[model samples]
Target: MRYSDCGGLLKISFLGKPRIEFNQQDITKEFGSKAIALLCLLMINRNGYCNREKILAYLWPNSNDKSAKYNLRFNLWTIKKNVGLDGNGNEFLCVDRERCSINKDYEYQCDIALIKDLLDDNIDDLEDLETMRHFFNGELLEGYYFKECNEFNEVIIYERNLFEVAKVKLLLRLAKQYENRGDLDSCLNTLEETVKFAPYDEDIVLKIMEIYELQDKNSLAVIYYNTYKNRLVNLLGTQPSKKLTAKFYELSKRPSKGVKLGKTDFDTNNKQRICIKTKCINGIKYFWMASVIKSLLEVEGLQLEDYLTDTQLRDLSYIQPDIANSLGETSARTEVPDVRIAVAFVKLIEKISDSIRLKIIILAENEMDDFSRSLYEYLQDMRLHVDLISE
Candidate 1:
């Protein structure tokens, strides 16, 4: 059943600091710590009766049977008195001399119970996953401690782990949904929200880096990678996996010290690089840096090797990775401004069009990008028949 307190029935929040609200009133302060803990116990075992002997052992293990039973009776009374009944006048707790339980038929909303129900399986509904995220304000029963019940605390720890995993699962699913919708900003935010909870999860970290790379936020990717790597080193006394490290290397790439001739020459293997650094290209000054960038990337014979990340190649499974290298062909990595690839792509299109007539149609010509505009102008130079249709 969907979690709700529509009828103002007993509602308990066991995820964070234990809270009880009946009829929309905060009655949590009226109950003692033991009483709240007892409510949590009953809620955990809501599906079936908790044996009276087991309850006594968990909550009052040190007390003799007489005192233990007395304590249990008093706590139960506190619960029943505060929780009272639902709208239909049905009691919310099932109490007997032999056992105790939360009435299964009771109309109520409990945060922990809701988490279990929602996380019973993988969730696809974004609303349900987001709703589950709101309940994890803190750990299970954050303010309560039952020093006398080691077993109960152990149970708390176990449940806490399960709740944590489910929370991460929903968060990941939510991120994927956002990503699929092309709301990358929202997707990135959702993933970051989960880092506070699952810092050690390499998969989450890997995903975060992938989004950063996709967004061309290489600096942020490096920052996040260093932060995570340092965290692992300090907290877990370990290092990131090779894949993660390789991602970092890919994102953290920079020009190594080499020759700085007034030309764009990049030879990584020989550690040689030539840059015009200033707002100029090949000793020609430009009033704007944009002009310099344009000139830099337009150099003759400037062939750049652009390698795809595994994620980018995820959909292109048929394109075997490093196929040329496997066949003893040299492959190189190139930095941004992969205009060389664009020039080559346009050339390939021109070559293909030589044998077969090709008509290029562009939508929203007003919003045409620089690359497309350049390609269009280049095609015009080739005297290719062109037509513009506009309303």
Candidate 2:
């Protein structure tokens, strides 16, 4: 269902799964990948032209056996039919012999762009941000991975990263809102939830940890630090920054009534192991790869049950993390991940540390963005210090 955003407001969501929820509404209807891709492409090139060739290049790049044109027409017809624009010739999908573009005259507002604008303006009103967030339900057509769909992959990744930044910004905004409302519990809860969704986000996690520490919830802070530390190491093959480690170290040295979970650190002696598999069919390559690294450094003989699934996709890739500690990378490079590497990564990390471990699987071939890269390094360093501990 489409919501008119002529002026009221548009909230955008591109998180776990892709859906577009109207303002103040939790109800969301699923959208097909084709439709979502079309919308996203149009929104990206909103003021520009997106002809049939562009759509075909993105949606059906591999089909060339004489029926490619037919397939293209069929797909476009399918999209237009679903949008209910063809019957009335509303110009939603304009085709002019050799060119096509989304009708520019219609009143359309992109939730993604609208939300960014609000944040950029630094609007202090919680209601306003919440109103914007109402439009978000999930990621941009999530879980619709296809090897012959680079255009889709690229666009979705771009939006996913943007959405992530928005999520963090929203959390900060919400935290401030709750704090102002004199609801420390709600404020803390919002930060905690934000941490779960973005475990690699240390700044937010640190903020939450600091709040907890200030509130004398040292145990909670310790728990979060340990969990976040493990998550970083397993995914990015690095450790936490010196500043974060110092905080955790300072906290550890403090007297506490909290139960110690396990060894706080994990080793990083083993090199990160990565295996990639690729297949090319009809000039389109399907790529898949898996990377395994250390989890935590200090615990002895502790094992975490494998919990892996696709959570976030950025830069033509989706990330699968094992429970909370290790990370696995899987991409359109291959439809299937290298399970052997995943299993090995888990086994190695489990036996080595009591701290949280992460197994990450990402679907993209390139390095992660700067934000994710920093997180990976911080976690890895945390694991190193843990491993150096002599029990």
Candidate 3:
């Protein structure tokens, strides 16, 4: 993976092995434990030079002699061997007698690299904010919580906290867009993730309550509403706003005018038949397709196992009208299957009619192997609408 900053970019690669290839073709390798320690020290000093004596003292405090130099030399040589040379045939991690610096010629793409950028609001590079979110796995070098690395660890932690703040802001923006479009499911998912980052935001909590009401989920709506009201009263010494109180009263007085209420037969079963299949798992495609179906179309009692058959592929299937209606469909009808081999899942999206859509989620990892892609392309040529979802 690649990350960048103002001074330069940090590049990391994992092929047969893991290595950091710096700008000057300076390489850090995983040759042994000692080598790893050396690399970590260099990373900690990414912005400046670390004198040889200081490096040696950091790694081996008591010892001072040819043995220590020899150990450092061996690891350095390993690092050079692993990372290729730079444009001028110079190694990136280098020492000229006494001083050494991680070369700034090459771009650096560390998670920390983007932190400073985010703070700068360099509008030219604002698009990189999203890239910043992916680099943070946890507290920087979480396992190496030594006192010597504490300062460096603090920098990483501070940067990660900033990225999280940015992520929550981004999610809120997306949630608003989804809400305006009346896509309650997508809106709720976005806000729910947002809550994980900023749970104390009453505005977000209110949005969640509104979405629940829109979905006619009054029970869930009531719970969050009460929680919101209680929090305001206990923490701020005030009740829920008049607007919010009135909304709760209106919602509690009558049945939810929820869209598509009596649409699916399984509404009471807790397992609604979103779709009807002539058979189940009739073929390999059918078997894998079952997984995606279960994930996308959720009816309380509906399941794929009931319709799968022994054949690898099949002819027709059906869905309960009510379940289809919940997903913006008006009716149901039997039709030919629509299958696609995705990177990770087998997707079957069928149109019950012109307006109704049926989607099946199938879990199949690496279904897009070299050969599979060619076959998939042929299937596409035949007008089969197969898509890939890696997650």
Query: Residue 11 in candidate 2 has what lDDT?
Result: 28
Q: Can you write out model 1's per-residue Cα lDDT over 1-391, one digit (the tens) per residue?
A: 3333233556778887778898889999999878887888888888888998998888899998899999999999998888877877789889887989988778888888877776776657777777777888888988667887998889888888988887888888999999998888889999988887898889999999899778766545655676677568767999999999999878667433443323322235422222332221233211222322233234322211222333222212222223234334454233333354444444534432332223333334454445445655666677632222221
| Every candidate's lDDT | 0.65, 0.52, 0.50
Ranking by TM-score: 1, 2, 3
The TM-score of predicted model 1 comes to 0.62
Model 1 residue runs over 4 Å out of place are: 1-8, 253-391
Residue 233 lDDT in candidate 1: 79
Model 2 misses residue 390 by how many Å? 31
Question: Model 2, 201-239: lDDT tens per residue?
Answer: 778877777777777655446656666666677888788
Off by over 4 Å in 3: 1-10, 13-41, 51-74, 87-90, 94-99, 108-111, 114-119, 122-127, 137-139, 142-191, 197-391
- TM-scores vs. true structure, each candidate: 0.62, 0.52, 0.42
The model with the greatest lDDT is 1
Query: What's the CA error at residue 284 for candidate 2, in Å?
Result: 60
